[model samples]
Target chain A: MTAQPDHPDAKAGHTLISVDAMGGDEGPAAVVAGCALSAQANPDIGFILHGPQEQLDPLIAKHRELAGRCDVHHATEVVTMDDKPSQVVRTGKNTSMWSAIESVRSGEAAVAVSCGNTGALMAMSMIRLRKLPGVNRPAIAVLYPSSNPQGFNVMLDVGADVRADADDLLRFALMGTSYARNGMDLQRPRVGLLNVGTEEHKGRTELKEAYDLIRAQGESTGFDFVGFVEGGDISGNRADVIVTDGFTGNVAIKTGEGTASMIGNRLREAFKYSPLSRLASLLAYTSLRRLSKKIDPRRVNGGVFLGLNGTVVKSHGSADATGISAAIKLAAQLSENKFNDKLAARVAATLPAEESPS
Target chain B: MTAQPDHPDAKAGHTLISVDAMGGDEGPAAVVAGCALSAQANPDIGFILHGPQEQLDPLIAKHRELAGRCDVHHATEVVTMDDKPSQVVRTGKNTSMWSAIESVRSGEAAVAVSCGNTGALMAMSMIRLRKLPGVNRPAIAVLYPSSNPQGFNVMLDVGADVRADADDLLRFALMGTSYARNGMDLQRPRVGLLNVGTEEHKGRTELKEAYDLIRAQGESTGFDFVGFVEGGDISGNRADVIVTDGFTGNVAIKTGEGTASMIGNRLREAFKYSPLSRLASLLAYTSLRRLSKKIDPRRVNGGVFLGLNGTVVKSHGSADATGISAAIKLAAQLSENKFNDKLAARVAATLPAEESPS
Candidate 1:
């Protein structure tokens, strides 16, 4: 439930978000700190923190900002980063990840935020929340820093289901465009199906099929299908939304992040190479800091679970306080907008035309 | 046809690299200029330039350095970048791209360098040179700048074919390692299979099967298989070689390039933001140039066609003189090392195990 809606037209609801306090690589302390930061910023914001009471209670107590805003849900078990998804799903009923999602399922919380492993988190979320009707494969959508005026492009499935056929890809396109509109607020978003080439005849068979399917829905779905975008276009200004199977999307995003990180490190090394260069760096300090902040990974930290019955934001497992807070901000924004409700409607609206392969 | 060998023990072979002086976005002048630069640096380098006789003749004659080194091959037809690969392979025999590959097929040129489109070039290379025995899918391998001491990592199947099966992935692994050895001079390269996640249980089924197949061959193949690697690992120092199907590999490499390009633009923008920052940029010019040169896309300009009977280097279609020179440098180096002969042997050695999935 989102209490304070950013949009005047958004329906009023509670602003409390469910969060898994354990399972993050930085542990419960970072999560508590992030929650406190969120609580301090929005007086309406609250969190149902799930973890062992002993571990989370003291962490919350130290953060005075979280004094009355945190509700400790006693989940005695924890899902380790290395736990297998299948293993966790069967035996993880009492795990913090499961309990966090349970709050969303039981309608006690509007959204669930976790820094646990992606596979396990998805496994737990899907089982607890279930897929929206007519949704074949749920997808994980993440915002990528790009050349857009909005400063980022939406890409999915980062890793929900690795394989997506023609129909599934069409569904991804529908869901992704809806996300660009509701989440990023890009009205009439231009969507592109990711491929090796921009040519219609290139790529695999399913891609060609998906190309037609996506193009056919361009007018009716209320988004322009910028047919067949290449990998460079993922960050290029060609399209606002890039839709692909989970496997390719996941690799593209990671590769982009890696390149940015390496360049960032190299940028610092260049400034430190000589005394004059370091002195010049001091002069250019403000501009460089702005550039760094513009590209910082923490500023764009959440991966939204789409086509699900409830909203779940999977933060990076190694996220520190800043990254966790960024994720919480995204979760709250989506919850406040009733993003899941709209995403489900968008998918259901497109399903009647598709012959469900599943 | 034998020219000077960079390695004394390397088998002697002709260093005459065939050139397709047409179909590039920049046209024939750039191709002739690139050849002139290559000829200027290496007395052993000669070009069998292919294009319409009238168009290429004047361009070659204008370049004084190309006077004796350039041989213009007459071809009335050209392969436009927009021409479909399927159509080219059938009706493109007279096209400059096809004629260039023909030189390699006839052993008139030790290797061929093309500034033509990638899909057409790969199609021409595969059809003219043909896949090596026991190889089902031929791959394109490119050297990507990375955190390694060698300064680059080899990633394959960038876009040769859109799909690769488990066995084809194993071939890519073998071809990639062989590429690292001969192309980059890494004796025992650490290879990784790109996936959505590093976990063995993660990714599509084909990837899991590829993990085992590649791991099994690591001992005999002389490269360390570093299990499953994510998109970030493509640039990270976790491995020396990254292998995947053309679909994922293409997206990964393009995404990386796009990101690097975006950051490069942003870096320029950041420095130009204010008068002080611009003045600081002048003070730090040399250091910034070094960083720019380190990450410049032009320096690493060639994409090698692997799993073929003869070695082929596909130059970037938009390559200028400097970029073209880099592609020629790579082509000359591969020929000097007798890389194609070794690559053929490497694939031949692995086929006994694949059961000929083709």
Candidate 2:
């Protein structure tokens, strides 16, 4: 029931990406629509869509560009978002997420993009692709739109594991720097260790140890080590790469998102309070639109799983076609840049033999 | 050398607050001005100002209400902002911060207010007043402006100690509940334990244990226990009191503040983008002003150090007269409500004999 690319022109110099089209909240239709949007924008991008073939084929056929590029791979199961990671690891062999990662492992695809459960995706990716040699733990690197010159800062270990020791944090720094360099095109990304305070004597004991380890590897890693940075610096231009344990990073990311949305909603209410204010909103609509675009979460919807043998981008599960397209575009860019190999080289070069994962 | 209160009427039925008028970024003049503002608002509030008499007398003289209400206590030394907690404990016996806490210790004032170094203030408060019986580590409770019916949610351990065991967290819950009851006048506040997720089986090991402990004591402690909450819930209306370890709570608070300020600055830029927007801003100026006042940090500028025998409110070091007055008002209100006695009683009642501080 596969939807094969019939046209020979679609195969010319194209890079294939495996996408899990089943588990997202928007279902296969949105996934197909997003693929169509991505294919329209990037002529050389193709997708191996993993889902129920009968369900994906009809949606894929609606868009001529997607029909010429996407090939459906029939997957029997879908990983429910509520499924435990342990449960998924034990019995999620034939799921769409697993099949999507399998495409990358089999060298049939350059990368895998998923809008599924984060825990299941990470578990399947680890078991299938395995961790890179000498990498202690894999991290989820998110591009935070910032006031930096690069327009975005790389923050890692967003939710890979709830814990990180000194060695794990150092690895995050190396991997994050590589991400900023390869993905965002920064030559020397300044790395800042996230903490409660910028003082040397503050925060947990592990943070202090991680600070020393990161400082020692700054020269070898080819990234400038800016000392400790507070939560405020995550959006500021103080650093290009912010590294923290998963718990702190995850909470901080959610906090920032919640705050932005809350402020946006309040601003809208202010503009609609009265007739004159509504008229003012009409007159200032263009500037407000520009401001909205600058902070739009859809523009940066991908979270790259670093320290893996293959690149994987996890889009928000409930993302619309615009957000999914953004994730697909990010996956395509990372694949074109050969981000995984460079990240591996960077990790192996900076991490000493003694500190390598067993 | 002390500025004696010549007016006898200032002493009648007034609540005295010991204030460290030095070591803030704005200097003693701002402190004096703030005290004057508070004095103007609350006629029954008096201050035991700790600083050099020469420097304090001139500023106190500027406001007739402040001059009549303030009694100067000459202290030869001042604790600098950069002074370590350990260093302050070792050699800061004669400093103004020490003198301010001493006033509370000697029963001359109901509570102490300081804008000095947080670590130093906490250290001095613990040493002078000591932790209440059955309380292991005292916590600093902050009032976050929220959408709750009370207009704010009480969050504890904002930057006290970075570590918290199950017992310490349980104690924080008790103290925070007491704070809301007395300080904010909530009859029965809903207490929430902050975690990375709302699920029963999420976050660190200690959080799970703390959740069970808090849940068990919900009826006895006179508050509803909302099991788990994420960072987004801090500013929401789900709970009135949010309890977490100092490290996570501190980082979360700073993260929220930073995000709000960043968005605020960007919003200002959007409104000033063009001549039309500038004109729009002019028409929508009143609504925008109301919105700004609602989120202004100054209106809620005090972080109360709970679990100590005496109450200590730490104002922002850079607080202006309005912010300082807000902090002073908080201290005065807590004194009027007998918050310290109520908090101590609450801790003594909830904590088992085995868990009591030695």
- Judging by DockQ against the true structure, name the best candidate: 1
Candidate 1, CAPRI quality class derived from DockQ: high
TM-score of chain B as predicted in candidate 1: 0.94
lDDT of 2 at B161: 94
Q: What is the Cα-based lDDT of residue B146 in candidate 2?
A: 77
Error of 2 at B342 (Å): 0.5
Candidate 1 lDDT over A163-183, as tens digits, reads 999988988888889889888
Model 1, residue B336: C-alpha shift (Å) = 1.2
Q: Candidates' interface RMSDs, in order?
A: 0.7, 1.3
Q: What is every candidate's C-alpha DockQ against the true complex, given to 2 decimals?
A: 0.81, 0.65
- Quote the lDDT for B48 in model 1: 82
What lDDT is reached at residue A27 by model 2?
87
The native-contact fractions of the candidates, in order shown, are 0.89, 0.56
